[model samples]
Target chain A: AQTIHQWPVAEIKAVGSPLSLGCTIKGKSSPNLYWYWQATGGTLQQLFYSITVGQVESVVQLNLSASRPKDDQFILSTEKLLLSHSGFYLCAWSLTHSQNTLYFGAGTRLSVL
Target chain B: GDQVEQSPSALSLHEGTGSALRCNFTTTMRAVQWFQQNSRGSLINLFYLASGTKENGRLKSTFNSKESYSTLHIRDAQLEDSGTYFCAAINTGNYKYVFGAGTRLKVIA
Candidate 1:
């Protein structure tokens, strides 16, 4: 069975501070990865996606960036946090070219004060 | 432009009753996935249909690619089933998925 892990389950940071959220995939190799954000009571928005190492695509420009440093590791970071950046972050993975099923991690709740 | 539209927006049902949630696609979609977002803010995958229909327990889902719509039927609704349900579609040539705003379902005892 494959599992996706995301951490710092929840974080509270000051404005203009750097932020980093990490995700790791187990039991799968070279799977497609995605990062999504859901504001308080808002719809889920696609933030970024990566197909392989050193390759990433931005879906929404919210001053946040993503990187695929390793095949099973994905990181979401920002140089400075904004008040609008507070929301729930989710990391998901799917089989290569098989987008029918996507497995999500536990998710991280970030609050920028 | 929003490629997916889910209907009812919100629904209230009594236990033992039933209802259906629908998703209409504006473009050709290769597959459809249904998910239930629980109170804890976790999304649980209900059904992933490439074509035709699939049923599990009290849940049944049907995907009609030609019609560009999919439906999820919930039978014998229980209080535990209360949550926001979302449907997403994958365009024929695109791997990215477009999600609906989600239909909030509240099951009353």
Candidate 2:
């Protein structure tokens, strides 16, 4: 079975502080990975997606960035946090492209103060 | 523009009752997927339909690409079935997914 794991289940950070969130996929390799952010009771927005290591595509500009350091590891980070950046960050993976069903992680809940 | 429109943003049902959730697309799509997000915010993929219908236990889904619509039917609902249901489709043009705002369902016991 495949499993997606996200780190720092919940975090409260001060505005302007640096932030970093991580995700890892087990039991799958060479899968397309994506980053999604959802505000409380809002839509889920796609931030970035990567088809392979070291390459990422930005779908929406949210003052955040993502990196795939390993085949199974994806990282989301920002130099400074903003109140507007506070939300739930989800990591998802698919067999190939967007046409396939996405497998999402438990997600990281962020709150910027 | 709401490319993927879901009806009845909210719904409530008693245990053993049933209902259907619908999603209408503005254009054709390659495929559609249904998901359930519980109160803990855990999202679980329910069905991935390219066309036709599929069923599992008390849940069933159908996708009509020609009509640009899909329906999810929950039969004999239970309290555990209460959650926010989301429908996402892959655009035939780009394969990018458009998600519905979600239909929040509350199945009371």
Candidate 3:
């Protein structure tokens, strides 16, 4: 079975602080990775997606960026955090681009103050 | 821009009762997926349909690409069924997903 793991289940950071969130997929190789953000009680917004290592696509520009360092590892980071950046961050994976049944991780809850 | 309009932004059902959640797309989509965001903030995949309908346990879902809409029906609701439900449709051109606002469901005893 495939499993997705996200780091730092929850975090509270001050504005202007650097932030880094990580996600890893186990038992699946070459899976499509995606980053999603959701505000409190709001719909999810796709942030970025990567089909392969070292290449990422940005869906919405929120001053955040993502990188795929390894086949199964994805990282989301920013030089500085903003108060509006606080929300839920989810990591998801799919078997392939055609098979888009996404499986999400537990997610990271961020609070920027 | 593609859009998904979900109906009944909120719903309440007594145990054993049932209800249906619907999503209407503004543009034709290639496929649709349904999810449940639980209290702990984990999104559980309920269904992924390219067309037709599918059922599992007490949950059933249908997606019609030609009509540009989808629906999820939950029967015999239980306490664990209470959560926020979302419908997301994939764009045929880019395969990027457009999500609905969501339907918050509460099951009361």
Candidate 4:
């Protein structure tokens, strides 16, 4: 079975501080990875998606960036955190272009003070 | 442009009762996937339909590509079914999935 793991389940940071969240996929290689954000009582918004290493596409840019340094590792980072950036971040993976089903990670809750 | 729109933004049902959730797409979709976001905020994939209907236990889903719509029917609802339901569509041109706002369902015992 495949599993997606995300670190720092929850975080509270001050405005203007940097932010970094990590996600790792197990039991799958070269999977398509995605990053999503959901506000309090709101819908999920696609932030970024990567098809392979060193290639990431931004869907709804909020000045945030994504990186896939390894086959099963994806990272979401920002230099300056904003209050608007506070939300639930989710990492998902799909079986390349052959599969449309997305398996999501546990997610990280970030709150900017 | 909103590619996908889900009906019944919120719903409340009694245990054993049933209801249907619908999603309409503005463009032709290659496939549609239904998911349930639990209280803990983890999304569980319920059904992934490319063209036809599929059933599992008390949940069933149907996708019509020509009509550009999909439906999910929940029979004999239970308290554990309470959560937010989301429908995402895969676009043929790019294979990028666009998700709906979601339908919040609360089943009370």
Model-by-model lDDT, in order? 0.91, 0.91, 0.95, 0.93
lDDT, candidate 3, at A112? 99
The sequence of per-residue lDDT tens digits that candidate 3 reaches over residues A35-88 is: 999999999999999999999999999999999999999999999999999999
Candidate 3 regions exceeding 4 Å error are none
Give interface RMSD, every candidate, in order.
Answer: 1.0, 1.3, 0.8, 1.2
Q: How accurate is candidate 3 locally (lDDT)?
A: 0.95
lDDT ranking from best to worst? 3, 4, 1, 2
Instruction: List ranges where model 2 is wrong by over 4 Å.
Output: A97-99, B93-95
lDDT of 3 by residue, B1-109 (tens): 8999998999999999999999999999999999999999999999999899999999999998998999999999999999999999988857488899999999999
- Is 1 or 3 the stronger prediction by lDDT? 3
What fraction of the correct interface contacts does each predicted structure contain? 0.25, 0.46, 0.75, 0.61
- Write model 1 residue lDDT over A16-104, tens digit each, in one string: 99999999999999898999999988778889988889999998899999999999999999999999999999998888875558778
Candidate 4 lDDT over residue span A1-113, tens digit each: 89899988999999999999999999987899999999989888889999899999998879899999999999999999999999999999988765578889999999999
Worst 10 residues of 2 chain A by lDDT: A94-103
The numbered model that scores best in DockQ is: 3
CAPRI-style docking class of model 1 based on DockQ: medium
Docking class of 4: medium
Q: Give iRMSD, candidate 1.
A: 1.0
Expressed as tens digits, the lDDT of each residue in A1-113 for candidate 2 is 99899999999999999999999999998888999898998767788888899988888898999999998999999999999999999999988644578889999999999
